[model samples]
Target: MVPRPTSLLAWLLSTLAAIVLIGAGLPGPAAAAATTTGVKFVDIPGDGVTLKANVVAPAAAGSYPAVVFPSSWGLNDVEYIAQATSMAAAGYVVVSYTPRGWWASGGEIDTAGPADMADLSKVLDWTLANTPADPARLGTAGVSYGAGISLLGAAFDKRIRAVAMLSGWTDLNYSLYSDQTRHLQSAGLLGLAAQLVGHPSAELTTMLGDFTANRNIATVMEWAKVRSPATYLDRINANAPAVMIANAWGDTFFPPNQLADFYGKLTTPKRLELRPGDHAIAELTGILGLPNDVWTSVRGWFDRYLKSDANGTQPGKVYLKPDNAAAETWSSWGAQTTSTKRYGLGAIRWYDGTGLLGGSPTTGWSKSLPNDLDTVANGGVVLLTNGISAFTGLRPTIWLPFVDRNRAGVWAAERPSTALKVRGIPKVHLNLTGTAANGSLVAYLYDLDSLGNAALLTHAPATWLSGTAGSRTLDVSLSAVNYDVPAGHSLTLVVDTVDPLYYDANSAGTITVAGGSYLDLPVK
Candidate 1:
């Protein structure tokens, strides 16, 4: 069973307290030159609130291209001090501010809702009026919450010319409720963080209440739609801001799949970079003014669009960096895949309780597994697992031999003669018959070595809760990834009922998997 809000909150607080040392020596706004010759912190009037902000302008500045950065969730104006200083030193007028109700800022937290969007416009207005900021060459950039607001600002405020949305979500609905399953850990962490460091509005409070209780979901999605940039894609395209999106493949809060979809629909000059990391991990070093690829590309993006520089990252390209491999670029998202192969799932062998995954299907068989129980195959703990993987170039691993077959259905393919460069999203098709009215499945794709050690490549979840029991056909697209399976390595698939990362809808029953299920692989 999923933990109640109180239990989740307690867990979150304890986890944060234990990991607080991770941030002990990190730079803060005090370490930044807030009162430097060309830098100053000030208070600006928001729509109906007061915003704490810092402005960094070129010391020998005429009017210059300006970039406004709204602080990330649970952060204040100093969140972007290093990035702002670097951008300012490079001849851009940069203003970074805390959004309403975060830290020293007044008003309740808007969660990047309408009021937050209004604050962004107000910050821009203040920038142009008070500093040597050129109104015509305006741009916005941020990470996480700031990134979402920046993207929405580009759609609502036409004066913005370019945007770099790092680790941002294009669709809020998908983030909170993907595959009709609540992302319990991610949502709980966000809600708890807001309550710890900021004031939550009534709307945000109610949204969390309905979200956790699994009630009024349609209304919650409606509210989310209004904040999603995907909902305003037409307006964004019409305004034509050069949009550059950089996200980690393992971003729990704002996954890369939605960013890829949003990037595909963009008619304006756009770039997408998918790397191996969790939410904001890929760009965290850049926040400390260290050398980072995402921030480098961010500066390059603004230079090209706002300053009309000739030497910037070329638009209309997608960059994918695989773990422990060289970065690869493509003309577009579609070009990431050359062809796809469908692997039919066969009957489970009685001796090992495992099935064969091959080119041809084997029907007339069924396998039953107890629901509401997790196996060795599960998505790792939300942030820490993926963040460690990003830095160490390793994924959460499992010994395939130890997997509990009674709790999960396992399938393995034959070893290929050559390496398989898996590039795009993997699709799973399954026919599930559940004894209970509600059930869920977490599907995992793994690369298994000769010794039976398996590394997670990608995974996704699907849930059925329409008060209908019996058979249901589920088509699930696993998270997009770029992984290479070495020659002589086999691909493994595992389907289990519960993962701690998501809310499990499964109850006390057995879910039977029918034969005719298959997995689709997109390989380059």
Candidate 2:
């Protein structure tokens, strides 16, 4: 497990000091054409405390539809004023509220625990009880934190006619821990953010301690499972609400793979949009002087599902814009296996002491790759950008050199015969053995251009919870991706042990890649 910060002061400083778009300015009426609206404060019977909420009604409204907005993590209900007001103007009895524990709301922070979930149910119930909300036309939408609860609400409460989520995680385990490797920075930052915005409940404080200390994953996972909507997806699908999912492919907090997993399982009237941006782009864009394309599309989604009015047209049925910042849409999310491109790992020495990543797919060779202790000892953040690169403008592609030439194995495809669009998850076939008691294997897939500037596609790691301690052959699936490796650009696959993002074996072991070692990609 990645070690957590030891000092309370360090944790406090990080959370309080680090705020993303807390005060980022939202644009003028152009982004929010929802018109001036009437607003009322509402107090409700929460699980064990009083819940504060807002009811923003369209200026000229009579039993209009209703839409509920939940604040993102660490934010109050008012944080979504622009969104609520805009929806209200569009004829929705817009209801928005802070979760308990934040912005002077009652109760302690549970991180979407039982209390939080119950609070959401009661909030919606109270909204209908007090406001002139059309119970049949109720809808919900939010980003990141709010996006998740909206899904949860729809899953348990069928009264929600429509639901839309952006940058929300479907599975907490997948988002927080992968291959037994805890996403340390993200997990830690989340706890700190919660602390900064809302003081912890006694239970939450204890959970935070276990998390920060890397004490035990079992405890953390159990708590996460209760709050994960994917756990209840089957139920959600059975009595599902009209769903719209806008997942940022590059969001580190909510991996696209998990989002796709949720989208695939939803058996309801649904739409999907996959864009490339970090965690907050869908919500923070309007605040940063950028056109609020995403929010505008969201309004149309509610207009259709909540009001039974298409209002002209909606965003794409299924939007996909991966790398290169270009977008395309389809009817639904499905596995697209374009032709296969295979790159074989060989024994040839390419860079420094590293084995070559470049060769014909037919090449078969056994090569001994050592473990890079120094790189394991001192590996920095893999990239400068936190999650996905921005969608607009031309940005520099990432160039990755071997951390330790001899210890890390580098394999590249012989430059593509033509420029090919590579999409979907790449599979790695490996035959390997351990020289020590136990070991781990890490593989990173990258797109290397003619001049050797490389950009990360996706990576997967495997570790032994407990092992045979000797020779083992394995096939590992890297993270699912929709990246395009252009013409003249070759595919680079790096294999080694240990990554800073994951728990490192920190053990010195040699795992030789036997014959039939190759990287298989989906090429279009």
Candidate 3:
């Protein structure tokens, strides 16, 4: 979690004083490099509160376009200083504000609730009234927490004509309670960060408590639905804002699967881009006025919609960057895959306690493992593991010989004759039987080299609460990703009961896996 400020008043005063000095042309190197003229800090009226904000516009601006940026979680109004300055120099009035309950802003943190939506409209009101901004040309953009607010703002306010959401989630339920299991680490990190920097609303506090305790799950799901933008997709389509979504494939907080599903349902002009990095890492440099592909695409998106510049924007295209491969473009998300490959699971072998993966379908053999154990095949640490992989291009790896077959079920495939380009979601189906009434299983897809080293490609988890007496079929869809498997490398599958990334229900039982199981791979 992030550390708290020494004193809220002192921190706020220091930040505002720096902005004032920058406006006066007497600040540090970074501040001096920004657009100096027409920069001012002000307090905008919110929903019965005051919002600390700043405005940057062209010095000789007539009626230029306008953009509003809401700060991310645990950040203040100065979060977008560099991008705001560059947009101001590009003939656009930019207003960046601290959301309520963070830094100097008033009111409790609503967590992108109704109050946050209203606050966004108020920021737009202040922008049109104070700056020389055209009312007809309006846009909103943000990252992570701010990204969710921006998407919801477009649905509430028809004045917003364009939107760019980076590292944001559309389905809150899918993010927190995907496949009927709790995403423990991601939710825990978010709760801690909010408590450190801001005051959570009564509803948010109650929901977090219930979520962690695994009590009143119904109430938790209902509360999350209200905050999810997917619940208001119809309203967004009716308002018809040109939307652009950019996200990283390895984002631990907000995965790309939900965003891809949401992108498929949009009727308005939209674009989707999935790159290789962790949450917000792909756009971090761009926030510093540095050259970045994601930020460049965002600028092009705004130019096309807000300023009607169609020089670089593709309205209905999907862009993807696979690991160790060139970027690819398609007409739509569904067009990325040309075919699907199905593999069968063979009986567990005695040589190395591993089974065949791609032979004919073999049945009548059952393998049982202790349910309350974890194996080496698991998702890495929440933020640090994937964040480091973003720069190193090395994913979490495991050795086949080290995996305890008594705790996990492992399967291996023969070396492929040619390279395989995986472009979409992979799925696994299993016939499971447990001694207790409930259990959980995590399925991992890996790329195995000749030396028995396996690199994790994608994975998913499933939990069952009833009908443990008989065999039950569980279908799980792994995360969406793009990767290339080189020739002579094999594909492997691993099923375990526990992963540190999620909360499992397995305890004091043996989960049995029968035959007639299969895996489906989507290839381009």
Candidate 4:
């Protein structure tokens, strides 16, 4: 159980001030306002540093609820003002500040560390002491790195009443190392750039060197072991409510499962909202706009908690937006609804003589010599005017290539009529036997539409079953998706020797894949 801030001494301080101010003939600010007026620049005192912040409040104000938006990436106070303004217009005082040393702030910007956390605490103290904000209603919200800071701050400070974390990571170690193993190619560079342009700290510089040399994974992992929030879950107070939003279709960085794991550990009254979108700041801004279902839910949550609206706030709100169903679509999981579905790899059958897999082998289809390990190359001839060729555009939509001793084989699945709707985790159960010493199997999930277009859903880790083995199941889970398999479209299951995005194949091995192997999909 987590301690409630309302029972803390700080809550008493705010309550006493409210009483004294009322007795002195001063009234609190009005709650209904179209725009915020008073804007003040303030300095927050930190350990050996000062943090700069922009405060927005109503003109006529003695006390009002406050929301804080922490700095993210390299964005400064000016860029955060628009988001702050919107919250301010909703009758809440808004404070957007540059975290640590990002811009015009003292001390170093260490992602989530003692210095950064202390600075955040100082910011809260300054806001409570200097602003007309009702200390009892303090809240924080942000996306990505900013969201990470807010979560960490709220974990330590009881004064923070509520929180909204968007696409944030609870374990940096898992996110940077385990989940995205090839970080040197992506997030590693971005982090290096941030250090070069912002902090210029020696530790950051050394870390950059380690990353560049490929020797930094160990050091980075050590750092993550110390700073990861997953290790500090018990420290998070459960009294304050939280809302976590994750993008199901995000590919830039951070896997959806990582977010799910974080959400599962939160003991607070929490709602997990998963959407389908890229890691675009615009999509987040759209969420803030409350233009549609996405934003509506978020605003409603804040209204109930921050404003203490009379309308009771419902719990356990889960929204899953399906892919390609509509221009913009979503599925809701509320108190009164329950739904579940499954998508799997259709069964495997013999390839007919005519390039079709059926009762007989396809004509002109010859199993070529063993290419690299665990793979076999097969060629087939089909009439150009055949319905199969016409419908498939003369190419296989689903390609499954396996890895064996020194060869690999490409296997393709037939297309479906309607677009397949994939909602949850899709697992591929492959039964393969190696002819050589040892080999590995890789599976890919994709969407093939009616227009002959193919897009990747998510990539899975390569599973090395056995080299001198009999038979084993290669299970790989694709990233969760709400994507629609279009009407007259087909879903694809590709098993290849390599995932170009993750790894390269060393030796293609000769392997036999049983046709009965099935794909188990969890759909909802």
Candidate 5:
């Protein structure tokens, strides 16, 4: 059974003991939005130093359902107080806390280590002891770092009645380092955010060093495992808090695949809102006084479980918003699968390829352009343009710019007699012979119109180590997406040597794709 405070007088005394940390110069946790009248900063004595948190309770509250929000990496309570006040207005007590080693907090940052998870438990205990937090109706929520921590905390503490995770990763290894390749762009930006906010912890500094130097990841491999919630699925499943995941469809940082894997492993009550945007845009917009799915779905989740007032909102439903397709909903995850359609890869020319879709197996082959192996500026630039720049803001009020691939090694299928809807990730198989010590290849899927204009649907990257002319077969999984193929349009696969988002060998190599290679798309 979950635990609760039985004595009100003792809890009040603890609340009165709240203190301002000396030399830290931290301000009290007060709500910027005036929706909640009773807002105050409270300090809870923790393992090493005091953990700082802000409490926002209903004005005339006797006992109210409570929700706690942990800051995203390098952020403090200030980042989430706006949402806390909104919860307070809905008659819920909210505790927004800064994790250890962040601004105005104590102890070195552990980045979701045991110390960080322990900080969550401390906030829970303090909430129950000092506020009118409903012992039976408590839940936790956050985005990114805090989102993963909520799952980690729920795994150990059964008291979390419900959970809402936004743009979080289920597997740390896959999200941070996929196929032993680092996601340099996202990780570097996140590390920059950490540095801008506070001094770096030893662990974080080590990770940055290894990534920038392109060193083997063995130095910090074990640390990454412990932080991943996928490492503790058994514990999370046993606790079984009702889960609602609200994430973007185009979030390259924590793509839909990671969320899909975690969602599939659970048997608990659940809901999914797969919107369209990059990593932080949709989520931050919602947090900072804007209307979006993250806050809406989370509040409904808390209402259903913590308040026991669901108002007929259904769980287990999948909400999806495709880029060019109509919005759709699935009854449940089990009902959301699409049929696998195989399309053959055929050589349009010696250096270019076009998709031979809906046809039987062929005995033809396609070879990549040696020109791509050249470092000189050429058509390769068009194939490798990712459309993301350093100036892009974290809070996006619009969709990410579309990728442009005009001159590329493309395998494309012309408009079919019938229309189809792509409902999931696209898989690619490559039977190729290459001559290079080491190399990496990237595959991007696009939906093209009769005019040859196209929008990028999904993309994937792979690294290979070979010396002589050696043959290898690669099965690659592109990004997870939902797109509609209009009757007059076409589906395409663009192959290239490098991407701005990841590290590439940039060395010379000639690759010949054999006849058996194909692109398999999940369509309906």
Candidate 6:
């Protein structure tokens, strides 16, 4: 039997009381039997301060499985209420708490340090002792920073039986300083904001300074080397099943390829779910302004693994949303959605006096002329060259939005053949050259099949090229798709410096290119 609020007012009051108690530090039972439901607070020992958490458990009196969610920039207890409520209603215990130095919790927050993992372990032990939670049925889940903590917890805590990580980063060093450019949108701005709000530590401020100045990757890599999860990958408990979910199409924060690399390295019974969306979990649900679908998925996964409940559970399932056709419709893996095809590069082409030959040896490529936002608000310029013949069969179109700019190019390719249906993600590789020592790069996939067609693929952050870069190869994996690239239709890769939707471009650098660049299209 699940616990129910006595009444609407009671539930509201209980929630208010919980909030007040968290803020004021007064020690009274902030909840009643009816509205209090199953939530409680427990204290854990920290290095220099005491750590506390707001825990929600199944209403029934029997021992239940538990899942832990660590704190992020805001109040973890409140941010995870939806998940807590859902998991509790589904008869599981959910623990949401602040990390060492955030809000009500005491001690300093060291981002993703060893101290945080130890704190998480202490919380796990506290939960098992104080509640009717089965110690053998523990799991963890979170998103972004919280997800990072969850990964760390699972790596150190053998008691955790499973984990669901959303948009979690694997190598912090690579994420912050890939290609010697700090990602202004994600690691730069968002990370700075989190530090300011959560810890306000001088160390965090200095770190933010290094990121803002576009310092070399080595500096950022040094910080990441001390805090990355890569060093602890082998420590992940093998008994626990892990589900790594990320948006291959996310343009704001992590690079999609890096996430894929992390997913591939997991030693546990792991799975990867790549979707089309930004970092927000709501995109997975298609419910604008509502709770994220990941919450439901988490509950279901916990129910299946922690409680051994077989209802509505399946393993190794991969879903890809159709591109440009319809929103909210997903196709199962192995379903043919795109026609397999390839596009050739090396064909001599010209764009505004820039002659494209087989290699960079063909000179005359210049930096992209800056266009006002209005000129290329939606997409980049489509260069029409006469030297190259029109493509035949299923082909991909390539377009460069930013010229002579570092980290602001969009590469688009034509859609695949209608007959060859595509079920998985589309991959594009390009051999690029630049005159500058450092720059950023991004790739996008567009669906031209629908009215007001939108981009179908946006990848996580990846290394573009840097350091007196000559010709460098860039491989981008887009979000999973099951759609038809109709006959006569084309898939375009928008190559640019930065995704306007996510980050701003480098206003202070010059990036020039030679004509030997070629985009290799692998459609499956």
Candidate topping TM-score: 1
Which scores higher on TM-score, 2 or 3?
3
Worst 10 residues of 2 by lDDT: 375-384
List, residue by residue over 1-524, the lDDT tens digit for candidate 6: 11121243233334433542354332223332333255567666655568767777766578888888875444455556555655676677778877877766887667777778888888788888877789888888776667788877777778888887776777786666554444443443354345544564565656767756645546656766666666677777354555545443332455445565565566665555654444533232321113455555666677778878787334555434433334332233333333545443323234532222212223344335222222122222111110011111111222323223232333333434553344555665555554344444555554444342433333332344445546566555553444555654444444445543233333344444334344433344
TM-score each candidate: 0.95, 0.87, 0.93, 0.71, 0.84, 0.72
lDDT tens digits by residue: candidate 5, 1-524: 11112233233222211211221233223443444665588887666777777888887748999998887775677666667777787788998888887777888778788988888888898899988888998899998778888888888789997988887877877776664445655665566656656557888888778766767567667778898888888888888888888777666667677787778887778788786666544565556655656687788889999877857246888888776667788975446556888888775553333445445446566555442332211111110122121123111121111322232456668787777688887888888765465666677776667665666677777666555546788777776877777787777777766554556543554555677778888876
Best by lDDT: 1
Which segments of model 4 are wrong by more than 4 Å? Answer: 1-35, 208-219, 237-239, 282-296, 310-314, 326-419, 430-442, 462-474, 497-518
Put down candidate 3 lDDT per residue, 312-384, tens digits, no spaces. Answer: 5789999998866899999999899999888888899988899989866679887897876888888876655
TM-score for predicted model 1 compared with the true structure: 0.95
**CA displacement after TM-score superposition, residue 520 of candidate 2 (Å):** 2.3
Clashes of each: 0, 6, 0, 52, 3, 43
Please give the lDDT score at residue 366 for candidate 2.
Answer: 60
Better of 1 and 4 by lDDT: 1
How well does candidate 6 score on lDDT at residue 272? 53
Question: What are the per-residue Cα lDDT tens digits for candidate 1 across 1-524?
Answer: 75645565556445543333243224434423443235688999999999999888877748899999987887766777777877777788899898998878999988888999899999999999998888899999988989999999999999999999999999999999888888988898888878888889999999999998989999999999999999999999999999999999999888688888889899999999999989888987777667889999999999999888989888988999997568999998879799999999999999998899887666898888897777888888777789899988998899999889988899999999999899899999998765478888889999999999999999998887879777888888999989999899999999988888899788887989888899999999
Comparing 1 with 3 on TM-score, the higher-scoring candidate is 1
- The C-alpha stretches of model 6 lying farther than 4 A from their native spots are 1-36, 41-43, 237-239, 244-248, 283-292, 323-340, 345-434, 440-444, 448-456, 459-488, 496-516
By TM-score, rank the candidates, best first: 1, 3, 2, 5, 6, 4
**Per-residue lDDT of 5 in model 4:** 24
Per-residue lDDT of 470-514 in model 4, one digit per residue for the tens?
555555665555566555644555554533223222245444555
Whole-model lDDT values for every prediction? 0.86, 0.68, 0.83, 0.53, 0.68, 0.52
Clashing residue pairs for model 5: 354-412, 355-411, 355-412
Q: For model 1, what is the C-alpha lDDT against the true structure?
A: 0.86
Clashes of 2: 6
